[model samples]
Every structure is written in C-alpha cells, then in structure tokens.
Target: MWQKVIIPFSVSFILIGCSEPEPLVEPSTVYQCAALTLTATVTDTGLDIQLPDQSYALVETISASGARYRDDDFAIEFWSKGNEATLIINGEPFPLCIEEGTLPTSFSARGNEPFWLASLTGQTLTMREPGSEQELTVEAPRLVEDEPIMTWSIAAEDGLNLMILDQYCQDSMSGQSYPYTAYLGREGEKEAGCAGDPRQLLEGVTWQLAQTASEQAPTIQFIPESNVAGFAGCNRYRGTYQLTGEGLQFNPLAATKMLCDETAMAVEDEWFRQLTEVQSFRLDAAGELDLVLADGNVIQLQRKN
Candidate 1:
C-alpha cells in the first residue's frame, strides 16, 4: 500500500510541474496599406487602404479578446458598418462617399499624392475651387486652403497631354485652383512656343524606333499640326490628329509583320499609346522642354545638346 501511494503521488507531482504558463503580450494595432504598395494589409484589421496604383482593399477583423494576443495576416482595404475613416481622394472637394463598396477594380497608377487619414464619415464633400476673378484678393478659398489641397494642374505637350503634380498655378487675384482639363490654342495654354507650326518642333528631333514587331522601317515624320507617321512594328502606321475640343483618331494604321524583340521603336510605341492626354509644356528657366501628360507624368526633353 505504501509503495503504490508513493509511486502515484510522485508521478502526479512531476506531470503538474512540467506544464508551462501562458506568456504575456500587448494588443495589436493596424495601419492602412500604402499607395505604392505591392501588397495590401491592415496593421490590426480595422481600417482599409486604397493603393496608389491599384484600387481599394478591405481588412477583416480579428476575433480575439483580452490584451497581448494577436494573429497577423496580409489583407487589402475594405469598408464596413462600424468602420469610419474619412479619406479624401486627390482633394476632389466632394464629400467622402462611404457605402458598402464599389467593386474590385484595377489600379490606374496615374498620380497619387501624399495624404493622411484620421477618421471615417459617410457624408460626401467636394473640395471645390471658387471660380477665377479679375482682381487679386488676400483671403479666399484658393488661397486660404492649406497645402495638400491644391495639388495638381493640367497642361499639354507634344502629341501628349499632361496632368502635372508638384507644378502649380494661382488665380493671382484669389489664390490657386485645380485645373482639371486643357485646351490648345486657347487662353491659359501653351502653343509649344517652338519654331514654325507645331510640326516644326519635332524637326531635327531624332525620334528613333525603340520598339518594333517587324523588319520594315516606318516612314516617320512630323505632320506639322496633324499627325505622327511611321511603321509600328509591322503595322503600316498613319495617325491623324486633332486639338482642343477634338480627339485624336488613329486611322487604321498599317505595319510590316516581321519578328523582333524589345527595340527603341517598340518602347516609343508603348509610350505613345499611354499618352492619352497632354497637360502642359514649359521651357523651364533651365532651358529644358518639360513634357507633362494628362496622367500627371513629366518627361524632360533636351534639345539634343
């Protein structure tokens, strides 16, 4: 009897002592996904994030209680009933629209500026610019609004339109306003201020074929104010032009069908395709011709010097 009791009691004591206690920790915190992010994730799982290049992503809540315990995972931004964060996309001046959600969309990656999010609200508000006036004023919405508000301007360049950020314009009388669109040969516009007709600007400017799909060389030339001609790979190419209120019509271009890899013509072909809008052109004080697109991309053109 004594032997059995001693053995069982010893075994029980050893087993109880072998178990370890739970470790201490702190609760978790979540952060919004970055605009330039390759991936979307919430820090703690409460707020959502809209990617700079991609659309918005939603975050799922973590079901946990007490402090010092959390499970981490990668996720996109999403909105829910309790979620309340005010996000002003590019300072449109419109009220923030909060709803169940739009839909999963791809990223335009046009232009995204720096901003911060504090809280969420359903009311929609637009950041509006008081129209232009003749006389200058000290206090006005254009001038009074803080930075991060007046972020971008629109202008045009060679065969391309630019939506420029970091570049600015002021009403002068009041302050600055958001210039969303542009019209050529009109007020508040640049005629490329080069030599002769718009076509003369491309004169002597050697635009090489950076990309091609065929063996035939394209008939590349500047059609003064109307078109850009040449061979796009194998497609015999002829592009018609329009300005101001008109649209650019690519007249069913033709090209040669030959095998080729990445070339200069190919690269330029792609660049031209992406240029849907031209915002502005400026011969900066540095004597550089800067081309800004409607999508807010700036390309500097040097005079082959």
Candidate 2:
C-alpha cells in the first residue's frame, strides 16, 4: 500500500515538473490591412499624419511605450504594433496612416539661416548642416510634430536625440499658422533641391540596357523636363514622366504598332511592364542606373553617352 501511494505521488510530481508556464508577454494583435507609407506634417498648432487611406489629426491620450522625440517643452511618441502604428504628442494620441509605397530617399530644402536638408536610405537618416559640409547621420526619425512649428526627432548614438525644427508661419490675411512644408521633410512632397535630379544626370545621354527581366538590348532617351522616349527590342515607345520624391510615375506610353519576332515582342512586353512598374531609382557605384519597382524588381541601365 505504501509503495502504491508513493508511486502515485512521484508520478504526479513528475507531471507537474514537466509542465511549462505561460508566457508573460501580452497577446499579439491582428491589425487590419493598410498602407505602410507614413507621411508626417506639422500644421500651425498640431500635427497631421497622412495615412495610406485616411488622415489622422493629433488628439489627447494616455502615455504608451514606443519611440519618443522630445524637446525642452514638448514630446512626441511613435508606437508600432504588428501592422498598425500610432503617434503620441505630449500625452496625446493620434492614429498614424501607413501605405504600401516607397519613401523618399533624399531631399533638400532651402530657407533662412539654417537650410533644411535630409536623406533617408534604408534605416538611416542623414541631415546636412546648413552652410557646412558637416552632417548628422542617425537612425530614422521617429516623431514629427507641429506645436505651431515643425519639429523632427531622431535617435542618436548618444542618449540625447537630434531635433530638427521648422519655424512656423502665420498667414497675414487669415492669421492661420502652418509649418514650412517646403522646408521640412514632407512625405510625397518633392522639390528641386534634394540629391540633384537623377534625370538631370541621365538626360542628354543614351541609356543601353545592361540588365533587365528580358535579355534585349533596348535603348532609351530622356528629354529635359517631362519627355521620355525609348526603343524596346523592336518597337519605339514614347511616354511622359512625372518625378515625385524618389520615384518616377510614367504616363500612358505611346508605342508604334508593329509586328515583331516572338522574342522581340516578348522582350518588349517585359520592357513595358518594367517601365510602368518603376517607383524609385538609384545610381550605383558602378555608374549604372537601377530603376526599382514596387515588387522590388530592378531595371538596370548603363550610360552609352
């Protein structure tokens, strides 16, 4: 009898020892599908973030854990969980809009005294100091706010964060204040100053296909301003282009109606698809131009000038 009782007790203790405890982390949330692009803007008195589908203005809320951008008088926090993100300003909360789009990699703005210059590549943010070659390269900015003036916060190597400010302006006629959007890093907002127009460097030169989805030696010519014409394998095509941020949006292309060999037509189809899908571009160290698409496809072209 004692043997049976001790055996049962030993089995129970063994089972209990083998059991595991529950995790201490909070349950993960499933967020609704939305865009990932975040556009930050500072208005006269508050902040406005343009999301993929809608816009959210800043409002009051309790504090939450996330990235923080702080100044002497104000603070902004950015929280990202799963597929969603929120912006908090001075204890206030606001929904952050996100979209599936490419962010601008480089931009420059000119204003009084300190010139506003910024470039984002991958996870890095580089801010060029005004009138000097010196620059502050840090992690991507986490918070952007307009307390009547525009401010940006980036995490630095040191404990202190780097802050960028854009002075506010009041319309004399209406008296409504607004941040200098032209001088700040506004999403989808493109001006002439940033990393000099990539087209300006590509213009006046013939580009021969170096690498593409189709193995065809197509050629292209980019006229100054908004005109671009190219030959895809056997067909000559023309289209207008609009540059926004670091991406190029192409108008409906006009191509000559002609019959070609099967290989050439296949190549042409691939070329047209590549052109339409192009969203951003970069000039590699080899001096080759790589036009990137939303799906991460790349059309590589080499200068034949």
What is the overall TM-score of model 2 with all chains considered together?
0.38
Best by TM-score: 2
TM-score of each: 0.25, 0.38
For model 2, the local distance difference test gives 0.52
lDDT of each: 0.31, 0.52
Q: Residue 80 of candidate 1: its Cα lDDT?
A: 25
Candidate 1 versus truth, CA RMSD in Å, comes to 20.8
Residue 236, candidate 1: alpha-carbon lDDT: 48
Give the top-scoring candidate (lDDT).
2
Q: Tens digits of per-residue lDDT for model 2 on 100-149?
A: 22112333333333344555444455556655543445676444665655
